[model samples]
Target chain A: MVDLILGWTGVVLVFIGVFFLFLGALGIFRLPDLFNRLQAGTKATTLGVVSTTIGVGLIAKGWLVFSLALAIFLLMTNPISSHALGRASYRAGVKPYKGTNPDLYAEKVKKESDQK
Target chain B: MRIEIPQFIWIAWFVIVSIATILATIRAIVGPTNSDRAVGLDTWTTITTGFWVILALYFFQYILLSVSMVYAILSFLGVLAIARYLERGL
Candidate 1:
């Protein structure tokens, strides 16, 4: 009974993860600009991978330790990489979507350049 | 001992993820700018990590779990390096 419950729970979690993964891909493909794509790609894929890894861990009882560790490592590193990428892209002069109105990062960059 | 997941369920999972992978690849190939390509690559790596985990479960291979973990670490480092290279100089 316990095994049966865990298996079903894992299946459900895996389904959720795959759905988010699909969304991330769709966003990466269909989004208008670099920053928009990065936003969609990073957030959705991070959640998707975390869920998928943990679900796999639950399904395979013996592999739980390593899967959990992978999931944790991904959760920590995915954001840092995405942040670095976004900063780099902006610095490299890839403009955001035209709808982006805040323009705060550009302002901050301008101030820093002026200070220098 | 492998848990008995239905075969159709496995097929469905694989098919969806495969489609997602293809879409991301298309973005990477035809992206308008370098940063757009980088975003596509980033998404692709992440999806591949998840796919590796699913494959490990499907094959019931404990060793593949380790392989996926290593892949995750390497991909993370690769993405970071790419980002740094894009920022100024390598």
Candidate 2:
């Protein structure tokens, strides 16, 4: 009975995971600008995919422990990848809010310099 | 008795993943710059890589796990190459 319940739970979780993933992709295509799209796409997918992956790990049973490790690795790496992408985007000169907003990174650097 | 997933559900998952792949393609194609496309492509490859692992698990095929290894290597290369190009203007 427990196994069956877990399996059903896993299925539902995976289905929900898929839905969020679709939202992530839609954010990528439908958002107005690169900044908005990246924020929407990256944030949704990091959590969505990791959640689905864990559900898959649960359903796949005991022998595929490596698969579980990989899923955990993905959970760790997705955020890092997004951080790297954001930094790269900023360095490449993609301005925020169509260049109207102040640059946060530059402001932080200025504040740190003044403190020293 | 052996258990099986409904064929329609399996096919539905495939279609959903494929739609995601297509959307990623759209991002890559319509991207305003190289970095934008690179981000899209990176996520696309990662998702496809995850799909491979899911298929392996669904089939209970141990050999198919090797695909994950290949994906790991390629993922690192994708990120490294893109970062390098972005840094030095390749």
Candidate 3:
């Protein structure tokens, strides 16, 4: 009984994971600029990876420990890396897509520089 | 009796992941800026990690799970290094 339940749950979770990944990839393609693409890729792909790990854990019961470790590492690094990439890109002068709001970061940096 | 649902689901997931990989590859190739390519590569790495997990489950090998974990760490560092380089040197 437990095996059957776990088997089905695993199947569903894997499907959801794959679909989320597909959506992330789609977002990378459809979004207009670098920041938007980074946002989409980081958020969606992180969730997809965690879901897939958990699903694989359920399917392969003995490997749950490693699966959980993979999920934890992914949760830890995905956002930090995305932030680093976005910050680097911003500092490197990749402008936001046209018609965006005032550059608050730029203004703040300028003010800091002036004060210094 | 063994059910075949797991096999079917794995096959379906493989198909979806393949499509996603192709999409990421396109983004990486066509990216106008370095950051765009970095984002695409990061997405590709995460997807590949999931693929490794699925393959581990399919093959009933526990070691490959740790392999994916290590892969994730290295990929994270690679992106971080690229980000730092882009920020400081470019």
TM-score of each: 0.96, 0.82, 0.93
Per-residue lDDT for A1-116 in model 1, tens only?
A: 78778878888999999989999999998888888888899999999999999888888888878888999999999999999899989888888899999898999877866896
DockQ of candidate model 3: 0.70
Top lDDT hit: 1
Model 2: residue B72 alpha-carbon error in angstroms: 4.1
Clashing pairs in 3: none
Candidate 3 lDDT by residue in tens digits, B1-90: 222554566678899999999999999999999888988998999899889988887777888888898889988999999999887743
| Model 3 collision count | 0
DockQ-derived CAPRI band for the predicted complex in model 1: high
Q: DockQ (C-alpha) of model 2?
A: 0.42
Q: In candidate 2 chain B, where is summed lDDT lowest over 10 consecutive residues?
A: B1-10
Best by TM-score: 1
Native contacts kept, each candidate: 0.85, 0.20, 0.77
Question: Higher-lDDT candidate among 1 and 2?
Answer: 1
Local distance difference test values of all predictions, in order: 0.90, 0.68, 0.86
Q: Encode model 3's per-residue lDDT on A28-110: one tens digit a residue.
A: 98999998999899989999989999988887666667788789989999999999999888877788899678668888656
Query: What clash count does candidate 2 reach?
Result: 0
